[model samples]
Target: MDFPETVRWTFAGLACLTLAALVREIRRLRRAEPGGRARVRWDAADQGAGLVLTVGGALGSLHLFGAGLVLTGVVLGGKAVRAVRARRRTTVGRPST
Candidate 1:
């Protein structure tokens, strides 16, 4: 494979691995706390995965796969933003230790 194709596959593979890890974490949390209060906080890895997926999708040129990847990326990115906002909100009123 050429450079661009190789890069694309690499990104895609990384994104998939990130996604798999996220799913595993979620499942573990669910099992540990069946009440559903265990939330998955989106971190840097999630953000990076979303970004890679988004760019890869845009450059992929395959309609269906591209659309799916783009949509997943958007959702992941949005969730990460929301998680950050929520975290900030929780700490806003607390005095610095």
Candidate 2:
């Protein structure tokens, strides 16, 4: 494959892997009895996975629609960060149930 095609495919593969891991983690969390720490960790992982996939998708489609993907990813990432921060602030000093 050409260099650009190779790069796009590579990014696509990585994105798929990241998305799969995220799904697996979500399923595990749903099936098991998890503590607050575990839940928080999962939440963080979820956001990270989302970011990874978004970036990968943007890079993979660099020839077309890449700009839109990048923009969407940035917006989503920002929202996730803000949400996480707000959640942490609200949960501070509270007992985990």
Best of the candidates, TM-score: 2
**Clash pairs, model 2 backbone:** none
lDDT of 1 by residue, 1-97 (tens): 1237776777667667767676776566556644444244343335444555544543564554455566667667677777798899999999999
Worst 10 residues of 1 by lDDT: 36-45
Clashes of 2: 0
Residue-by-residue lDDT tens digits, candidate 2, 23-46 = 766666677665544555545465
User: Which stretches of model 1 miss by more than 4 angstroms?
Assistant: 1-3, 34-38, 41-97
Instruction: Give lDDT per model, in order.
Output: 0.59, 0.60
What TM-score against the true fold does each predicted structure earn? 0.40, 0.42
* Cα error of candidate 2 at position 29, Å: 1.2
TM-score of 1: 0.40
- Tell me how far the alpha carbon of residue 52 in candidate 2 is from the true structure, in angstroms, after superposition: 3.8
